[model samples]
Target: MARIRIDLPEHFAFSTTITLLLSHINYGNHLDNAQLLGVVSEARLRFLKSMGYSELDVEGVGIIVADAALQYRSEAFHGETMKVEMSATEFHDFGCDLVWRMSEAGSGREVARGKTGIVFFDYRSRSKVTVPAGFRGHFA
Candidate 1:
C-alpha cells in the first residue's frame, strides 16, 4: 500500500515526557515494540484529557483502533527520557487518524514515528458511528 503523509492539524499540540521503564524493555534491552505501543496508549489518554475529553466522551461516539503503523528509528534504553508528541491529523466521517512522534528527551534523537486509525462505533447499536460534532470541531 502507498504511504500517505500524516499532516497534523495547524493548532494541535499535545506532548508528555516519559522515562523508559524497566518493564518497558525486553531481553534484548531496548524498548520493546509492544511496550512502545503501551506508551503511546498512555499518551493518547493524557492528550484527550488535556483537550477536555474523557473516555466516556469518546465512547459516546465509539473510538477504536482500526489500524496502526510504527517505524522505529533509534533505541530507547532504560532510564532514558523520551517524549511522545501527539496530534490529530484528520477526521473522517466515521473515524480519524492520529499522528505521533517519539524522540529522546535531551538528545532529541528520533525514536519512532507512527499513526493510528481510530474508528467510531456505537456500542448499543453494534455498528459504526459518525464522528461527533464536538470532536470534529475540536480538530477542524
Candidate 2:
C-alpha cells in the first residue's frame, strides 16, 4: 500500500501550544499515537474558537470529521511543550480539510503532520449540508 501524503498549506491561520502529559506517553516512552490525535483535537478546537466557531457549531452547522491522516516524524516526551499549527484547505461544496502540523516548541523539530476531512452536518436533520458561504469567506 502507498503511504499517505498530505500537502499542507503554506501558512497556518492559528497556532496553540500544548504540553505532553504523563498519560500521553506510551510504554515506548514517547507520546502515543492516539494521544497525539487527542492533542490535535484540542488544537483544532482552539483554532475554531479563534475563528468564532466550533466543531459542534460553525455558522449554524456542525462538523463531522470524515477521515484523518497523520504522519509521525519525531518522538515527543512528557512535559515538553509542543506547538500545533492549524489551517483550512481543500474546500469542497460540502466540506473541507483541516490541515495541521506539530513541532517542538523550542527547537521546532517537526513531530507530525496531519489532515482531517471535515464535513458540515445538520444533526437535527441527520444530513450532510453544504459549506456555508460565510464560513468559507471567514477562512478565505
Candidate 3:
C-alpha cells in the first residue's frame, strides 16, 4: 500500500472534520472507497461555503475536476471521526491541484491522502477560463 504524505505551504490553509457511520461502511467492514470520496467532497463544499462561495456560486468562473487520485493507507472504521485537510500545491493560469489528507481524529495519524486537479470553466460560455484573480490570491 502507498503511504500517506503531504507537505503543505505555510500560506495556504484548508481543513474540515467528519464522522463515519454504518452507512459509510462497506461489506468488508471498513469505509467504502466511494464513500471516502463523498466525505471529502462534503468537507470541500463545507469549507468553500464557509468562505462564502460554493460549486454553484462560482458558476461563471467555476471549476470542475479534470483528474483525481486517492491512496488509502489504512481503513477507517464506522464511528471514527476523521479530520480531512486540503490545500493547494500548484496554481496555474487555467486551474489548480488540491491535496487532501485524512487522519483519525484521536490519534492524528493520516489514513489516506489524495489530490485533485481542477480546471476553471465558464458554464455560460461553455469554455475553459483562466483562474480568477480573487481565487488565485488565496493560495498565494
Order of the predicted models by TM-score, top scorer first:
2, 3, 1
* Per-candidate total of colliding backbone pairs: 0, 0, 0
What would the TM-score be for candidate 3 when compared with the true structure? 0.88
Q: Give a tens-digit lDDT track for model 2, residues 1-140.
A: 99988788889988999999999999999999999999999998998899888888998989999999999999999999999999888999999999999999999999999999999999999999999898898678
lDDT of 3 by residue, 44-138 (tens): 78766766778755534777888878888899999999998887668887988878888999998778888878888888888888887777776
Q: Over the full model, what C-alpha lDDT does candidate 3 score relative to the true structure?
A: 0.80
Model 3: per-residue Cα lDDT at residue 132: 77
- Order of the predicted models by lDDT, top scorer first: 2, 1, 3
Q: Which candidate ranks first by lDDT, i.e. highest?
A: 2
Compose the digit string of candidate 1's lDDT tens values, residues 6-116.
444444377898899999999999999999999888888888888777644673655678898888888889999988898876677788877888899898998988888
Alpha carbon lDDT of residue 83, candidate 2?
Answer: 96
Whole-model lDDT, candidate 1?
A: 0.81
RMSD of 1: 2.5
- Which candidate has the highest TM-score of all? 2
